[model samples]
Structure formats: structure tokens, C-alpha cells
Target: MTAPADVPPEFLDRLRPICRELPESYEEPAWVGVRWRIRKRTFAHVLTVDPDHQMAYARAVATDEPTCVLTFRSPVDELHALVAGGHPFYKPGWGADVLGMVLGDGVDWAEIGELLTESYCLLAPKKLAAQVAGPAGLCC
Candidate 1:
């Protein structure tokens, strides 16, 4: 199967199962790339940001080349710790709890799964959220 034009197939392949395992979550095309949603809220979104066209992401990461980015929600308290080191992670401007991760080279698939699971818990209803285990050590 062909990958979507905006993001690489390998990235999607890695992400799909993690999101799929969440209760009641579904995948759909977003305006720029792809997103996984629980009910009506988006838990995770992956897209390619062209430095020339997507200035916000480009400026945040300070990259001259195109970047594949994954944006997901995190507990507000954990946001700082996640983005502190900087490069692969950054707090996005739009949401208080939203964080963006640069997806390429040496990326950690296990961490991504944990983050996405936590993200799903954040947006999902209590009943639905409890259906799946939260990330290790994190109480969602």
C-alpha cells in the first residue's frame, strides 16, 4: 500500500498500531497529514512540515529542511520534562498540553507508544480511558 504524501510510510507504520490499540480510537486524514482520534478529540497527529510553508513548526524547530512531526497531548505537569532537552521534542504554541516531536533517525518507538497511550487517556472519557492501561508509572 502507498503511504500518504505528507508523511513517510515508515513513520505511519510505526504509529498505527500504537494508536489502534487504544479503545475506541480511529484514524483519519487531517488537513495536513494524519491523526488518531478518540470520539471527536484528536490524541495524536503526524505531519510533514515544509520549512518554507509551515513557518510555525519550522521556526520552533529551527530547521531548514522538511520535517516529519508528531504532535500529541501530555499532562501539563509533564510537558516541561519532555521538552526540556529540546531537539526531538518541543511544546507547541497552540495548546497548553500539546507537545511536538521530530520523527526521524534514532527515534524511540517504545516511548512514542507510551506517549500516545497517555495522550489517548487524556482526551478519552473516564470509562473509555480506563479500558486500556496507562503508560508505565503515569496515572492517566
Candidate 2:
């Protein structure tokens, strides 16, 4: 699938390698940005154009700088702690199981990679998840 026209190439350049590492994950346009999905389930989605999303994330993150929001699945128990720990993340209005994190300067790519891996494992089929899990163990 082609990268969404609205998504910045620089962001995609950094994101592609992480997403592609997951088994059977594919990128495509969804809503106003891009999403990585496994079969029918979307494990990660980006919101780059919507003003409401931007404002909400900026408010949650307490930053006015232009930033892209990446919403991804997290373990139900870890969701609260992640956002509460001042990690530049928050819970999306959509649900409690998913969390939104601001992606911009000073972002930790290694952590992002781990989050993406966990999100993919959560949405991918068992066999596929197993293939990707390997030595990483289940969700990080």
C-alpha cells in the first residue's frame, strides 16, 4: 500500500522500518493520516491533520509545537500508567485499551519500536504474532 499523501515523508521514513518488522503488517491511508493494520484490525493509526486531535494532544502533552499523534494499542493495565507517568501519551476518546502518544522531537524510537511490536502482536493472528514474538517475549 502507498503511504498516505498527507503523512510527512520524514515521519514515514522513520516509521516504515518499525512497522514492516511486524509479521503481515501493512501501511495504508486511513482517516486523515496513515494506519498499520493486521487483517481487519488496526493496531496503530496516525492523526496529523485534524485540528481537534492536534489540540487535544497538545493540551494533554502541554506542548504547542506541531506534532503528529500516533494512537496505538497497549495492554489494558499499562494504559493508565503510561499516560499518567508523563510520557507524552494519553488515552484516546475512542477507548480505554488504546493510547495516543505525541511523536516529535526527543521521542524515544526504541520505545516506539517496542510499542509498535506490542500493538502488532495484539492485533495480528496468533501464528503471525508468534513468528514476530521470538525472543522479545509477548507484549513489552
Best-fitting candidate, measured by TM-score?
1
| Candidate 2 RMSD to the real structure | 4.1
Displacement of the residue 69 alpha carbon in candidate 1, Å = 0.5
Clashing pairs for predicted structure model 1, backbone only: none
Per residue, candidate 2 scores C-alpha lDDT tens digits across 1-140 of 12222556677788889998887789988856889999889988875633445565557556554457788998888888898886678776666688888777798888888888888887788888878753456544
Q: For residues 1-140, what per-residue lDDT tens digits would candidate 1 score against the true structure?
A: 22332898899999999999888999999987899999999999998888777788778767778888999999887889888877799877789999999998999999899889989999999888878775454436
Assess the local accuracy of residue 72 in candidate 1 as a C-alpha lDDT between 0 and 100. 95
Supply candidate 1's per-residue lDDT for 9.
86
| Steric overlap count per candidate | 0, 0
Kindly give the stretch of ten consecutive residues in candidate 2 with the minimal lDDT sum.
Answer: 1-10
Alpha-carbon deviation at 19 in model 1, angstroms: 0.4
- Cα distance off (Å), candidate 2, residue 16: 0.7
